[model samples]
Target: MTCSRMQSVVIPRHFDYRVLKCKVSSISVWNHLSVHRSLAMNVRRLEVLDERAAGSGMGTGDQTKEMVPGGISSTETDLEDTDDELGMHEKHEQYLLDALSKMSHLESFAWSCNHSPISIDLLWPMLLKCHTLREVEINDNLVFSPVTNDESEGDSPNVAVAHELRAVALKSNKHVYGSAKHPDFTRVKGMLNSCPNLESLNIAYTQPRSLPHAHLSADDLFLFGRWPNLTSLTLTNLRCSPSTGLDAASSFLFAHLNLEILHLDMSPGTATWYNKLVFPPNCLPRLRELKAHRDLVSSLLACPSDAPRPLEIIKGVRLTQATDLQQSADAFFFNLRRHGVNVKRVELTSWHEMEDIRRLIESTPKLTWLDLGKKGNGNHHDRLGGSGASSSGAAAKSSSSSSSSHFSVVNANEWAILLSAAPELTTFHGVKFFYEVSLQAQASIANAANLPLYANGSTGNSNSGTGPAPGATAHVNLNLMNLSMTDRSRIRKNDETASMLAWKCTKLRRVDHWEDGGGKVVVIIRDCGDGKEKDKVAPRWEIRRVKQ
Candidate 1:
């Protein structure tokens, strides 16, 4: 049976041994038992979870015995009990090894022991035996030792033995309130060296913990270069040593031509203390997307020229300082245009000015998606032209006036000018449109439709309609295809915008509006008519609102 099929088959109690063995092709045996022997041997993918409860069990049986519930125990009695517990622990480890040895065709293995730290020495031998293994995950404060006996040995045994391994995840299972104990860096490096064709590696905290030493060192960054085929790498809370310069770090990362996606989180501290990354030209040739801290992005944008490879997407944490943010924003777009980078998607925490938005629109003509909002609630307060106070004043003025108002800081005229610059724009978030602008857009559409038709029945001269004026090009193709906004003004719940869209914005298909009371309304437009007989009957427009 396939792995997915095997997962869904629930075994009922009271089945015969033959029947049970036949149907039970895969099992996750938490503990070593005689009843699971037959089932365990047939299992191809196994996940051995830690049996330790939150505050309960100690690591080994001996350690468990040392922590007696009673106040104080005699040393002689405790020593005797410890020896007895140690013998039982040795037996238990042997039993586990013996059981794992039966699974000759095991493909995947995962072990998590947060409360009870498992010794890597006990698990390595059994893992080495599984030549078919492709993925391995070990978490929960597991202690690791070098796979080889010689400390001076250049290569480890696991890398040489696990030929089929493609993915490895090593993490701590520390509770939110507890301190994190990271796995040995040397052991982790050895594992990477073993899997030359490794594609994905994730080493991060399983929960929030306050342990600075647990962070990966700057020198460890070079270990990633060993895996030439690595496609995805995720590292959280990485620490940079004073000796390691940002230039070296950037150069090492740029050397990885095969890397496509990277997620990085620097150690939490003052941004100024962090070394600025210096990316040279033609770096990250195959990198299509990057998600990192603002400091890292700022350093990248500081590069003298455009990136050697075309970056399509960038997502990063927002900078809080106003001056630092403005400089970063300016540097980012300026470098993008100067380098001729063809980035089409962006997600930023904030944009301070309308000019910045305008310049961004002009720089990336192919941009199709944009998100400008705070991290949690997606509320955007930054204005296009003014400071926070000025933006509030603009909003107040907009609310009182019917003919003009500011939506997310852009006035009606400014919105038209800004939007007109982006030819391929679509899927915008956190930008509302004033009612007056909607009406104006509708009027432009009506004017375009009223223009004289040619003798052959095709659209006339581009400059014929009042919408285009004397020499200006008509913007009939400018459609807000997918719009996401919050209606703070709370205009009347009429079909004014919908009607304008039907008449002018022919290509607009969806609009998501957030109402005042934390409710959402999604408007979808569908054409419900056959393609044939265009002249005989007008096309039908169906507008529907789904409330959330």
Candidate 2:
């Protein structure tokens, strides 16, 4: 029933019944008449790879017949005549169509063919007979043409209703390149309209390829509104006109209030579309998660004071290239804060400044998960933290004074201040901290002296000393579940300091220190309740590195 390397299969002539389920990469319908008959009669679910036609009965001219005693070759000419009678392409197409026609009771069909294009004219008529079909996936090259006068209209009552169809995916083959040939947008739209009750659609291309000149435009995408009950929609590399703004697109999307997730990778040229995108208040009431480019995020943030809706999650915001990263971030965060929007999760796919991080923590008080990690890039050392801040001139002076040093390290003192700001933080990833014994010593001294660390009520001494102050202890109450850091050697060298830092986090569980070249040394910390008086006493903590 399950196979990975099966090239061909044969069914005996006596097997005249149906196949309830059939999954195969290649089928030799031409070579085995009984197999073809069996498949045609009873395939409820059919999945095929359709890599190439099998058993075409064609042989290379290199096949030669042995000369008999009379110097005559008999079999070669006979084979050539047979091959000429049944052309490879024609035979293959006919056999596939015939097999499809036999499956009148089929409910689902999936074809993944990347080698060659299939004519929809040959497949559509067969599908029209499977009125019970519910799902279809065809990831291949499909040549589409308009219906002719002799053919029935797509929406005619004579056509199969396909009322049970709920999902369809018609992604293009990855091997097809250039914009020269592509699925007709009109035909694709017509096909989608046929699935009246479809709820989920994913037409995203997996690989890079230029779309045809007549690709879907902003207005064409508005056809999505036809799927009234649609819940999830994903379209990648969709081409749009430069003259068309996001207003139309947003209006169309707003009509789909039931959508829970919407992901779009608009054509690169449409990056400027964000400038015109708008979200009216109370729009997309059920949309909780969105994954798009920075433009969409910027557009949402830039909405009129009375027009924006509260979103639980907004991902793919870019803050790296902002003229004033801090100002831009503050504006974005403050806008959300002013509107009383309680976005619990935010993901920035670019570098963020230290002040921006501070503003983010300050604005999104209910945020539990924050990810500022760079994707697809191995270098983690260049992340902006507290190292290069001009405001931290005194701290920078003690370290490398060179302006060329790009690595920003958030020392223990800075971390205490930041972590203290965000109490609800549970998962923090992709931030590097500079760990050193001297910084910990300063923090210890400040705590012992009962000196206020910063104006923010943080307790950490900036003055470095030989050891911890007498009766000095570090304590913090937080709900942090995971913390990821870079620069391992520094953390390893200051184990005592790191331990002190870890001890303060009451709900701390795990720490990840990433190496420069792309490996992580994870340290797991478990809170073992204080023995004998577990309820009344604070829990004791244990820390150990997880072996690779």
- Give the winner by TM-score: 2
Indicate the residue-level lDDT of 502 in model 2.
53
Report RMSD for candidate 1: 13.7
Flag regions of model 2 displaced more than 4 Å: 1-25, 28-47, 50-110, 120-135, 141-159, 177-184, 205-216, 242-247, 298-310, 324-330, 375-420, 432-523, 529-548
Worst 10 residues of 2 by lDDT: 477-486
| TM-score against truth, every candidate | 0.59, 0.60
Give RMSD to native, each candidate. Answer: 13.7, 13.8
TM-score of 1: 0.59
Total clashes in model 1, counting residue pairs 3 or more apart in sequence or in different chains: 4
* Model 1 lDDT tens row, 409-482: 33324444455565555555545432322333334434444533211011222422222444323333232111
Which parts of model 1 are misplaced by more than 4 Å? Answer: 1-44, 49-99, 143-160, 173-184, 206-215, 223-225, 245-248, 270-275, 298-308, 317-321, 349-358, 375-421, 430-523, 530-548
Tens digits of lDDT, candidate 2, 1-548? 26423322323221222322221212243223223455455555655554443322332221111111111233323323234433645555665676677666677777655553445555755785677787887765442323445543534555455677877776764454322243335556657766778777777544325433434354565645467787777777665554543556777777777777777766666766754566875566666677777546545555554444556776766666456455545566666566426677777766546666677667777776777765223254544343433223322322422332345545545554665566666555565443221334334333444534211112222222321244443332110011112212332333433444454543333333423322432332333234553333222112224433
